[model samples]
Target: MESPDRTVHVAYDPYVIPGGRTIHGRADGLNGEWSVHLGRQTSVEIVAGLTDGLTRPRSAHAPNV
Candidate 1:
């Protein structure tokens, strides 16, 4: 089992805007596809929505959500 204290990463496609780079839409309800040895909850879900990032749209360099 994985510890809740540990954080997991999620990624999605990025889009270009008139101002800068950002996600075209919300990345919510996608955590269900994540798996980090979360034994009891192999398919745990998040009730919140993810914000759009300009620089790092992918999970590689995400700052604060």
Candidate 2:
């Protein structure tokens, strides 16, 4: 799945394959740099929520760090 603006991309694989990655993501940052992320054996619920959040629009208000 990808964001509406095509700035973010994510992939997930639930199958258990040896040395196979479970999740991969690429995003274009505000700083004009690209970021990559990888995950293995991550929880389904967590990945689901991450995908869900990426597909939705961000809030106008900044989040508390």
Candidate 3:
């Protein structure tokens, strides 16, 4: 998945690394700023949940509710 403006991107690829899957990210189209190696023993659902929280929008103040 990517940011709405497309300056940031995150992806998961199992084949890019030899022993395990990876979640890699970059900003401004530059070289990867960071990566998380799931170490061959993680599930897609967990990854999805993580990335969802990572990319989800946020607000400075709490809602009234």
**Cα error, candidate 3, residue 46 (Å):** 1.4
Count of clashing pairs, candidate 2:
0
Model 1 residue 10 CA deviation (Å) reads 12
Model 2: residue 4 alpha-carbon error in angstroms:
1.8
Task: Give per-residue CA lDDT, model 3, range 1-65, as digits (tens).
Answer: 66665544555555665555555566445354676777557777887776776566755683632
Ranking by TM-score: 3, 2, 1
* Candidate 1, 1-65: lDDT as tens digits: 11232333433323322222122322346543332112222222321133222222468665555
* lDDT winner, 1 or 3: 3
* TM-score of each model, in listed order: 0.15, 0.44, 0.49
Candidate 1 lowest-lDDT run of ten: 35-44
> What clash pairs does model 2 have?
none
1-65 per-residue lDDT for model 2 (tens digits): 66666666665553545322233344345435354344575666776776676566678894832
Q: So what's the TM-score on candidate 2?
A: 0.44
lDDT agreement of model 3 with the native: 0.62
lDDT scores of the candidates, listed in order: 0.30, 0.55, 0.62
Q: Which is the leading candidate under TM-score?
A: 3
